[model samples]
Target: MMKYLRYALLAVAFLLCVTVALANRAPVTLALWPDTVTAFLGFGYAVTLPLFAIVGGAVGLGLVFGLVWEWLREHAQRAEAAKMRRELEQMRRAHPETAARGATQPPRDKVLAILDEADGSS
Candidate 1:
């Protein structure tokens, strides 16, 4: 069901993009610099493309940058998680008997543990 819904959403979006492209078939010039700047530089670059192309390109660039920004922002969290995993592994290795016993046995109640400790001490 979720897969079908996702497909339907994608179909709708594709149709919308096609409609936008068809509706905006007019060619638009994209210039790298203003007329004054071009005149000063003596050489300027530009391209002519459909309005839809420009809009799509901008959206694609925005998505790419946003993803990269988010990944970079979470770098510290990822590093910390990796550090915790390494520390946990080290502890398990340092106490292999305890780790194996813990996995095989049901958890002991705190009260039971305290009573056992008192009995052992006495």
Candidate 2:
């Protein structure tokens, strides 16, 4: 089933990540400036972290940025959808009779409506 296949895939991915982490357990120094620049500036920041941690952090940051970018790009669509919903509500309130009739109307397909009635599942 799809559920089992998905679980197996997830397991494989987890194992791969674990293997990578174990293989890259050595500490890596992350420096903000070159040695010469640091010497001239008299101040530089650096942190030592496991290579796996750095790699994972970069991947996580990329995902976060991508999500934010997409949300920003879709802002207009979201705003338009909200505007249309408000307009629909206003129209529904303005014409209560039409809204009621629309709700009671049968499906567009006459054959489907007949079948639904016959099955008593309309």
Candidate 3:
């Protein structure tokens, strides 16, 4: 499942690169810089490229945002795991008997421990 998602994302990236190349190759000028004319030199006009620069810029920005989001997610998960570990340790320290009994036996022996205690008392 994970591998398939990765392959899909890679395919999308490849397609995006292809699209950018094709769009840039469409033989349209995105920006025109004019020189040697005093009034025209300083003035600039916005013209259309073969495809909108907005599209290419959006794709690039999306990829960056996705990578950053994934990194932050994994970091947050790791921090949460460490916090839970610390809490468990503090809890064990506060309950000496529970900690000792838990250490001496496997977790599956919980019911057996209760039964043994009952039998001993009776």
Candidate 4:
């Protein structure tokens, strides 16, 4: 059900994008700087692109930037999680009794516990 819904949403978005692209078929000039600025700087660039292409490119760049920003921001959390995991492994190794206790504990889920019991009795 979730997969179907995702596909439906994707199809709708694709149709909308196609409609927008068809409606905006004209070429648009994209400039790195204004004419006056270019004249003063002696260097500038411009390119003719479809309106939809320009819009899509901007959106794609924004998504890439956002992903990079988030990955950088979460670096500390990822490091902390790795540190804690290593600490847990060290503790498990250091305390044989605690590790045995954990291994002896029954499955927490009711269905798995019942299955274990059934297997033990068989």
Best by TM-score: 2
**Minimal lDDT window, size 10, model 2:** 105-114
The superposed Cα distance between candidate 2 and the true structure at residue 82, in angstroms, equals 0.4
User: Lowest-lDDT window of 10 residues in candidate 3?
Assistant: 29-38
lDDT of 2 by residue, 1-122 (tens): 99999999999999999999999999999999998999999999999999999999999999999999999999999999999999999999999999999999875898886887999964
lDDT (Cα atoms) of all candidates against the true structure: 0.97, 0.97, 0.78, 0.96
Provide the RMSD of all predictions against the true structure, rounded to 1 decimal: 6.7, 7.1, 9.6, 7.9
Per-candidate count of clashing residue pairs (backbone under 3 Å): 0, 0, 0, 0
Give the per-residue lDDT digits (tens) of candidate 3, residues 1-122: 99999999999998987876776655444454554353566776656655545566667899999999999879978999999999999999899899998789856687898999999999
Q: Give the per-residue lDDT digits (tens) of candidate 1, residues 29-112.
A: 999999899999999999999999999999999999999999999999999999999999999999999999889998889999
- Superposition error at 116 for model 4 (Å): 26
Runs of candidate 3 exceeding 4 Å displacement: 1-20, 27-56, 66-82, 94-122
Once fitted onto the true fold, the runs of candidate 1 whose alpha carbons sit more than 4 angstroms away are 105-122
Error of 2 at 117 (Å): 27
Residue pairs whose backbone atoms clash in candidate 4: none
TM-score each candidate. Answer: 0.79, 0.83, 0.33, 0.81
Q: Tell me how candidate 4 scores on lDDT.
A: 0.96
